[model samples]
Structures are given as structure tokens and as C-alpha cells.
Target: MYYTDRGIEELEGRRGEEEVSFAWLSDRLRTFTDLNPEFETAVDRLATWLARLDDDEDE
Candidate 1:
């Protein structure tokens, strides 16, 4: 397993049963960037990748 997989697993394990709105996620991401400026780019990339998942799926 990759190092990042631990973080992913923790996320899934902790919140897998929860359902959240885009606004909630956006706010969370913003807060994350505020606290972790260095990770902003990775978060941005993840958001962009997620935003385009549908487009990719249709291809």
C-alpha cells in the first residue's frame, strides 16, 4: 500500500457512512488550505480531478 493510502483509508473508515454536500466539502477544503497552505495545490488537483470525473467517465 502507498503512504497516501493510509490517509485515504482513514478518511473512508471515519466518514464512509456520512453524506456531505458540496458546500460543506468546499468549506472544509478552504479551511484545509488555510491551515495547510503547502497542500493547497494537491487539494486543488484533487478537486479538479474529481470535478472532471464525469467527463472522464463519459469518454
Candidate 2:
């Protein structure tokens, strides 16, 4: 498994049962990017990808 999968698994194990809104997730992403400026582009890309997941045009 990929190294990142460990973090993903840890997240799932820690908070999988919690329900959160996109707004909440967005805020958390923003906070993370604020603290980790180097990851800004990656966070933005992830946000855009999540935002477009339901768009047929993107597919």
C-alpha cells in the first residue's frame, strides 16, 4: 500500500463514523493549507476535484 494510505486508514479509523459537511471539510482544508503553505496547490487541486466529482462534463 501507498504511504498515504496509512494516513487515510488512520483517518477512517479515527473519524469514519463522524458525519461532516463540505463546509466543515473546506474550512479544515483551509486551515491545513494555512499551516502547510507548501501543500496549497495540492489542497486546491483536491478541493477542485471533489467539487467536480458529480459533474458529467468533468467525466
Candidate 3:
């Protein structure tokens, strides 16, 4: 498994049952980026990808 999968699995194992709103997730992402400015581009890309998940345009 990819290294990132460990964090993903931990997140699922720890909080998979919790339901959260996009607003809350957005706020958290913003906060994370604020604290981790180096990942701003990655976070922006991820947010864009998630926001466009249902779009027909090719990635």
C-alpha cells in the first residue's frame, strides 16, 4: 500500500462513522493549509478535484 494509505486507513478507522458537511471539511482544509503553507498547492488541487468529481471534463 502507498504511504498515504496509512493515514487514510487511520482516518477511516478512527472517524469513519462520523458525518461531516462540506463546509466543515472546507474550513478544516483551510486551517490545515494555513498551518502548512507548503502544501497549499496540493490542497488546492485536491479541493478542485473533489469539487469537480462529478464534472464531465477530463482531468
**Range of the 10 consecutive residues with the lowest summed lDDT in candidate 2:** 50-59
lDDT of 3: 0.98
Per-residue lDDT of 1-59 in model 1, one digit per residue for the tens? 99999999999999999999988998899999999999989999988987888997688
| Reference-based TM-score, model 1 | 0.87
Ranked candidates, highest lDDT first: 3, 2, 1
Residue-level lDDT tens digits of model 2 in 1-59: 99999999999999999999999999999999999999999999999999988898767
Give candidate 2 regions above 4 Å deviation.
57-59
Better of 1 and 2 by TM-score: 2
Q: Show how many residue pairs clash in every candidate, following the order shown.
A: 0, 0, 0
Q: What lDDT score is found at residue 40 in candidate 1?
A: 89
Off by more than 4 A, model 1: none
lDDT on C-alpha atoms for all candidate structures? 0.93, 0.97, 0.98
